[model samples]
Target: MCSHYEAPENERLLAGFGVAPDSKLPIDLWPTHMGPFIRLRHEEAREDDLPELEALTGQFGLLPFWAKDRKLGRQTYNCRSETASTKPSFKSAWKKGQKCIIPVSAFFEPDWRSGKAIPTRITRTDGGVMAIAGLWEKWKDPDGQIVHSYTMLTINADSHPFMSAFHKPNDEKRSIVILPNGLIKDWLNSSVEQTTSFMQPYPADRLKVENRPG
Candidate 1:
């Protein structure tokens, strides 16, 4: 299972984000170290957190879709790479060919705080940017508040040499999906059946992991 993911707040804010139609793409801001706080209604942020976010993302000319309520994203963000077509939240998007590509310089993941763990950064070995495949949706609250959010998908680490260990920790759980630029476009535009074929190991040899940097 996947848990957390990382992206550049600046890219989401500034980039036009080329994707198919009807995709409800959602991008958050970065704090100081992380991107900006694009993740409103996090585990604590509330639903009425649009004005502030609009200001931040607007600076870079981004169209930020605020979260409607806080229930779905409170826990349901990432859908598994293998089963996204069957899940309720993702199935619709998958069927309509609604997909987007998230650009990233690297991904941040914390090693287990307990057991055999340490902090690290997983980035492209070639030191280039990556375009991760993700699904987006628009949902609303009982009061008719509309919000848009997206999730990162993950698959089993079958060939990733360094990441296989990151999939499971002693008494802890962690792992994320990192798509390379080579296959990202196809992943975003392909049919549901075609997309599943691209969920393979995500090209482990193209990535490198180490203590967090940048």
Candidate 2:
């Protein structure tokens, strides 16, 4: 599961995702930290018309409608694709087709092969931004405040050539879904039944990783 990632800069967001956010975002984002995501401008637009995408700054973790507080996002930053449609914290968004794309410059994972945890930064080999698949939601607090949040969707990567190398040997390997540039629009407009088709692991050949020590 992914717990941290590097958000794309404003220029990269505009150039890569074609949407410019109104405010500057933190470069490094952890669960509950503010980050940017792209979703359809109109949730209820007709299928015949092409959808317009919009970028918004939202909490890195997803907040379900029933969540009591924003702190709940800390535990929900990543949602498993296998159980997303049934899990309480993610089912509503999944079922409602609240799909989104998380634009990240890179994401960090732990490498445990050397008997120690080394922070590894994963990014596109071409030096482009990664369009990570995600889900977004809106929550209303008791004071009538609306909070926008999102969660990265992950799939089992136990047999994946590269991603399987991360995490502990005893733990199930997983990876966040990275959509190709051509599928960005299709992903945001996909129905619940069509989402599984886009949850596969990205090709290892197109990715590169390096130790990102602090």
Candidate 3:
């Protein structure tokens, strides 16, 4: 599961994701950091109207209605696709169809093949921003303030040629679901049943990785 990533710049957000640019978000994002995500606009329109996408900044981790505080976000940043509909922290968003796309320049994962943790940056082979599948939520805090948050959706990557090398050697390999440009719209409007079709891992050949040695 990914815990750190680089958010796309305002220009990329507009050009690549087709969303209004916002310069307030930080470039580097962690579990509880606020970051931008693209989702279907929640506005009233005619039945035949095409869905509109909007960009909103939200905490990186998801906060369920039952969460007592924002601290819950850290542990809920990555939701496993296999149990999203059943997991307490993610079920509500999944059932409500609160799908979103997390636009990132790159995501970092740990490579332990050298018997040490090396940070590896993964990005699209064509140098385009990645559109990762995610779930967003709107939660009310104790102070009566509304807080928006999101969680990246992950799928098993044990068999993936590239992704399987991340994390520990003994741990189950996993990867975030990176959506193709053509599927971004369908994913935002997908029903629970259709979600399964998009949960597969991104093609290993289409991704390139840079190992950061420290």
Candidate 4:
């Protein structure tokens, strides 16, 4: 599961992904922290009108509107694609179509080849930004304050050539859903069944990794 990531900062990179250059967002993000997300805002749009994509920052972990406390968000930072539509933490967002896209420059994982974990940064081969699929929720705190949060969606990676190498030796490998530029809109608008098709490992040839020394 993705716990840390770099947010896009270059104007050209943001433009390439259809993100507004003026959109406010943090440059780095970690689980349970604030991060940027792109989604169609429909506060006033007609049912037949298409809402424009907007950038907004929210807590990385999703907090269901019915949640009693924000602390639960920490454990919900990553939602498994296989159970997102059925899991208690993410099911409501999935059913309510609270889809979103997280613009990331890179994400970190641990490589255990040396019999210990080494933090490794993974990026696109072309060094462009990647769009990670996610779910969002709006929750009202006890103070009546509304807070928006989100969670990254992940899929099984045990069969993937590259993704399978991460995590512990015996643990099931998992990979985030990195959406291609052409599929961003669909991810934000597609029905639950149709959206399932987007959950897959990114091509290994299009990715590169850099290991951080201990």
Prediction RMSDs, each to the true structure? 10.1, 2.5, 2.1, 2.6
Superposed model 1: Cα runs more than 4 Å off: 1-5, 9-68, 112-116, 142-145, 167-175, 212-214
**Residue-wise lDDT of candidate 2 within 21-83, one digit each (tens)?**
898989999999999999988745535463377888899999999999999999999999999
Whole-model lDDT, model 3 = 0.90
Count of clashing pairs, candidate 2: 0
TM-score of 4: 0.90
lDDT of 3 at 164: 94
**In candidate 3, what are the lDDT values of residues 107-132, reduced to their tens digit?**
99999988998889988899999999
Residue 24 of model 4, lDDT score: 57
Per-prediction TM-score to the true structure, in the order listed: 0.62, 0.94, 0.94, 0.90
Worst 10-residue lDDT window, candidate 2 = 42-51
Residue 8 CA displacement from its true place in model 4, Å: 1.6
Please, what are the lDDT tens digits per residue for candidate 1 over residues 37-81? 122122234355422112111111111234334544535445676
Clashes of each: 10, 0, 0, 0
Instruction: Output the TM-score of candidate 3.
Output: 0.94
Task: Point out where model 4 deviates above 4 Å.
Answer: 10-14, 18-24, 46-51, 212-214
Arranged by TM-score, best first = 3, 2, 4, 1
Query: Least lDDT summed over 10 consecutive residues: which range in candidate 1?
Result: 55-64
Residue pairs with colliding backbones in model 4 are none
User: What residue pairs clash in candidate 3, if any at all?
Assistant: none
